[model samples]
Target chain A: MTDNSKTLLELRNIYKSFGPKHVLQGFDLSVAPGQSVVIIGGSGTGKSVSIKCALGLLKPDSGEIYFDGEKQDSAKAVARIRERTGMLFQGGALFDSLKVWENVSFTLTQNQKMSRKDARDAAIETLKKVRLGASVADQRPAELSGGMQKRVALARAIISKPDLIFFDEPTTGLDPITADAVNDLIREQVQALGAAAVTITHDMASVRKIADDVAMLYDGKIIWRGPVDRLDDSGNEYIDQFVHGRADGPIQPSM
Target chain B: MIFNPFAAIGRASMAAFSEIGRLAIFTGRVLLACLTPPIYLREFFSQCMKVGFFSLPVVGMTAVFIGASLALNIYVGTQFGAEQIVPTISVIGITRELGPVLAALMLAGRVSAGVAAEIGAMKVTEQIDALHTLSAKPERYLYAPRVLAATLTMPILVLIADIVGLMGAWMICVAALDFSGPTFLRNVWQENIYENVSVGLIKAAVFGMIIAIMGCYQGSNSKGGAGGVGRAATLAVVGAAVLILASNYVMTSMFADT
Candidate 1:
């Protein structure tokens, strides 16, 4: 059990909807300090919304969010949470118009005191931590390959050494080998930062590689959660069907 | 089934009203960001260069050709004793009407389309969401600089266009119309006061704001994928043009005596 006092981030009974489509209902998640929690769910299951609500990127229709054990109900509290966190988007989302280093050092550039040269140098240093060479730092995001872009995004996310990091399908489009490498990099970097991580992905390999604990989202709420070691025997029919990749099960495909 | 025409009309009206309300709120937030901290000086200067400097050639070309054409048309139209007032009418028409309108229309096509496409792409790819998580307000980092730049730069661009346009009239008057260069220059200066210039510049500033707002609004609100971005660009240009013409009429009415 996670000590409530020690929770770095927590979402309690979040509900969000767009028009008539109810995306999240009674969704809850919590990440302890230095823990890696991977959320598993089918597409459109609001796995992403869970983390987005926690980050305050998407306001929940109803919920309470706490960061660093402080309730983020006020605008100032939400701003503080945003300032202390980093996110790696599914598409990498590097600014295509900016050079690689500029993309990596984006937050620092907003500081007004960091010279462009100094920011670029810091970006290059962070890139090396993700096993990228300085040469790639000058190239545009469009000029890089998919795997390289993911690494660059990882570098960007960790460049600030944030208190928490959120990854949205961090390995979605990569090759199996590249995905494994990124998963390793994510685990190593999160440990190095001593930061809690909440990742959203349905990729089972990713879950096994990166999650200290696993949470399953279904029908707009968390239905199952357990340590990674217990994932195979979670015994929840939904999770069992999901883990075994079975078509014949209680979980039905929607039209 | 059953198609109810009045119900459909009501729905359409409601949608349009909703869209207008959203745009108003969006513009309000951007304006507030303009006065707040973290103004993004580099982006402001960069947008100024883009909106004012880079647009010089297009604006210049349009003004010059229109000025020359107006001089010829007025010279031909007033073949009787009214020929002497050709320079005055040409100067008034260009500065008070054609110069600002043409320049803004050109910008509606160029700047609006570009801004819409770029911001639309960013939105679809989640860069805007990334900005949100990064603690960077998109209104501050993206919208306001462009808005402020366009607002400030349009008048400057129009001022240059006014000069180029007058020069075009002067060239035609001296070379083709047999008017004395000295008299033509003197007439243009004495007849066209600073009021004519200020009214047109004021119109240009408002038109510039419309272009930026339409572009950024359509763009940041865009979704889906490439098709969505394409639609945003199209809507931005169309919206800017419509608003430009509509606002131009309103302002002209407000300053009817001038």
Candidate 2:
């Protein structure tokens, strides 16, 4: 939990399930303005599900999602939350049908009704911000390599200058070097926008590079939440097993 | 687990009803999106080309062969009787029965399956979710255009099929069956071409909506990964085909002169 006055987004006492599998049980998380909170958890621990719930992509059977410290109880409120936030999905999730520039400026043209020429110029500038060349803008998503695609995806996520951003395993398929490069970009962008962020990733390097605070999820609850510096010494066994990447520990691998 | 036949039947029925409810809701949303302003004409036109233009060759080819064969069969069957009615009967059958149904079935295999696969892949890959985050409504941006295109294009496609089918029947009736080409044309023209063609086009529009809706429904709701997408595509084709045939029968009965 965070202070009510400063909290930007919060999922309070959330409970969710998929058929018989209870994915989130009384999970709670909050992030203050301009903070980057990385959710660290093992597979199927409902890490991504929590973020999805907050964004209203996956409805929680019972939960309250607060955006800008207000309860997102109405359809209008939920839609507004989504309209204001951006996400970088694990697979980049760029429209393969659209060119890189089109993918980046999708929200601009679709949501804001920006003219094509203006949106394209904005897309090119954003691509440049992500270190992508202007020549790369006309290419399709499939034409780009893994790293360049993530940069394009990041460009899309930041183009609208959202006040809140979600990154779902932002560096999943990239090589170590590229992954680190992406993490740096994510860090710089989040800082530059002064936005609140909630990211779910298995990559500790990503955690260290981007997170100001860290939350550990296990058994459908946030077992630990603290500043990133305290992740190793939080003295929580689940955090220990995950951070050290040890197979034999209290945190048994899911069979 | 014990096999309880009654419970199993109940569960199956409930699942079927649930699926029907979901489809109905999806159909309503798609229709609503189609009617409202801010319609994405670009996507609709692109889909028209994809659903209509790309599918023309196959539907047209099927129509020609079918028309030729239908005329041949009618000639053979009528040898002991009114062989002169072959042209009239062939034209009627093509417009009233074969043109709309065959064109629809062809599109079910092509457009329906293609939409399902593409959208299902997008679902699994989180492109749909990405769209949500970007403030784009998936129903408006994705489903509406495809549905509108199919509904608008199927009628035209079926109309073309009817003409091409009549041409095939004419060629066969004159060249092979020894009927005069002018006589064949006169026979078809004497019949109520307006009624039959209109019936077929109406049937086609309904079938088109069915095809696109089933595809969009199965695709957007697909789960898992490649397997889920494959299953969605299969379901789309199957759902569209079955609905098209069933609706064709219903419309035929309603429009029957008897």
What is the C-alpha local distance difference test score of each model? 0.90, 0.91
TM-score of candidate 2 on Cα atoms, chains taken together: 0.97
**What clash count goes with each model?**
0, 0
Q: List the residue pairs that clash in candidate 1.
A: none
Instruction: Quote the positional error of residue B146 for candidate 2 in Å.
Output: 0.5
Q: Which tens-of-lDDT digit does each residue in B14-112 have in candidate 2? A: 999999998999899899999997798878898999999999999999999889888988988886644458878987899989999999999999989
C-alpha DockQ for predicted model 1? 0.77
TM-score of each: 0.95, 0.97
Model 1: lDDT of residue B40: 90
Task: Write model 1 residue lDDT over A1-255, tens digit each, in one string.
Answer: 233358888889999999999999998888888888999988888888788788777888998989987998888898899888999999999988789999899989984358999999999999999999999988999999999999999998998889889999999999999999999999999999888888999799999998989999989999999999999988899999988888788777654
DockQ scores of all models, one per candidate: 0.77, 0.88
Instruction: Write the residue-wise lDDT of candidate 1 on B1-258 in tens digits.
Output: 999999999999999999999999999999898878879998999899988899999999999999999999898888674335878888888888899999999999999998999999999999999888878889999999999999999999999999999889889988898888888777777874588888999999999999999999999989999999999999999999999999999999987788
Candidate 2 — which pairs collide?
A: none
